[model samples]
Target: MTTEHTGTPRPSDAELARIAAELRALGEPEFDAELEATPVASLVRELAVPTAFALAFGPTDSALPAGAADPAGAGGLLDVAPLTELDRARVWRKIVARRSGGAAQHHGPRAPSWRATWVAVATAAGLALVPVLSTPDRAATPAGRAAAEALGSQARAALEGVPGEQDGGRAAELAAQYSARLSSSGSEAPR
Candidate 1:
């Protein structure tokens, strides 16, 4: 007599339990293989060259040589003659003299106008009153101070609990473990 086997293979209870335990114990996979395969160096070079070029050339506007609306002529459109060292020095002296003359005229003795005097007094009064009006009256109540202190203490405690230095290292390790597990198990972890 011939015997026939039918239907799908059924996993035993023990086998199922073992599989679940393995799943729980597994962490993320090492993504080193994928990272190694990636052309990270080339990508870095690609990103750096353009950024450096942009910085060296300044902004891409009318100010830049390439970004100019018209590039047919050498230098800029302005036809101002190039100044010699002597010419520049003379021009500088004239500008200085004009500025000094203006300053002397303004500072020379003069009676203050009624409108100017009142305006100066009003401006001084406003400046004096600003700090007084803007400053919050912290001494107005004891309850407000107590609440602020309590909130500050709570924030300090929360900040203290954070593992500052080891945070990035721990995160990287966790990510690697997760990737490894997902790869081995052939399942995508939920986001």
Candidate 2:
């Protein structure tokens, strides 16, 4: 893919270098002084690692030969050229491309839809509960007994204050029936 620039032309390398020199000349005095005072060895120790990674899995090898070459090229400061306008532009373009192209292609497996995810979760729950429900004597389990007791108490509480048309013992009869069923099976009675 190509990005065609339609805005103002990018600055040339010489112009970028001149501007960088001017900015350096106008540097913050305190910060520049502090940086100058910081020893190179201390700065190297602090900035040796670009990331928070540490060697974890490999065997220990602290001792190296007297004149072993630095394979990682971390012996001293690298001789690097100043960044030009083109470098800055390229970096900006990369960042923009990453942000815009995030949704353009699927990197891995496509995610399931919300509805499909819910359906899958419900199916798994139902399957998991099948054996528990099918147990012949559910009240035999401690969890089932606890559930039955909780249900019976809730039913009695619900029937406490409702007004009835007559003095019929309907509420008492319902509560008794629910208690009996719970004592027997720890499950709701069939409709």
Candidate 3:
């Protein structure tokens, strides 16, 4: 039955889902007799030449073909001189250079800057201090005092173990003793 146009607005999601379900219920469509009889190869052969011509010459329906020969000698591509051997070599070199990242290297490596050096130094210093910062304050603890005494004893033993006479053995021994005392006293001030 022919229904007159209702001029309805866009269908809702529900309407669309219903339409889709109806379409899915239908099996594969049967081609008309004429279309069924037409060979695909024959169609391709018929259109191939025209398609190639249209592609090469641009759209055929236009009044003048695209890139049509300029009449007033506006210096089209045909007028240009062929590349010389040197020109060809230069072009090839440029292409190879670009492919090999040589084009990027034209500016060369960046020179070391004072700011970058300072940043690197600061980073290294921060990294060096990380262990020191992460460790808990041990100077006030009894364990720290025992550790300092052990270190001082080890240092004295190490000094005695040396075969040759030390230049400032007395001074070194005194410094070790002082360091141990300072560690046990929980004194933050540098001696």
Best by the TM-score measure = 1
The candidates, ranked best first by lDDT, are: 2, 1, 3
Instruction: Estimate, for each residue in 107-190, the C-alpha lDDT of model 2 and write its tens digit.
Output: 323334545688999999999999888878733578888898999999989887666633458777787778888778957654
Best by lDDT: 2
Root-mean-square deviation of candidate 2: 21.9
Candidate 2 local lDDT, residue 4:
14
Error of 1 at 69 (Å): 89
lDDT of 3 by residue, 59-175 (tens): 422112333422321232223233345544543353344424422333334333545688999999999999989998755578888898899999999988877535598678877
Q: Write the per-residue lDDT of candidate 1 for residues 1-191, one digit (tens) a residue.
A: 01111332323322222222221122101222221222221111111122333454343321222222233222221232233445434433533454354334444333245457889999999999999999987683678878988999999999889865457987888888888888788777635
List clashing residue pairs in candidate 2.
none
Estimated TM-score per prediction? 0.24, 0.20, 0.20
Candidate 1 ranges beyond 4 A from true positions: 1-112, 138-140, 166-191
All predictions: root-mean-square deviation over Cα?
45.5, 21.9, 26.8
Worst 10 residues of 3 by lDDT: 40-49
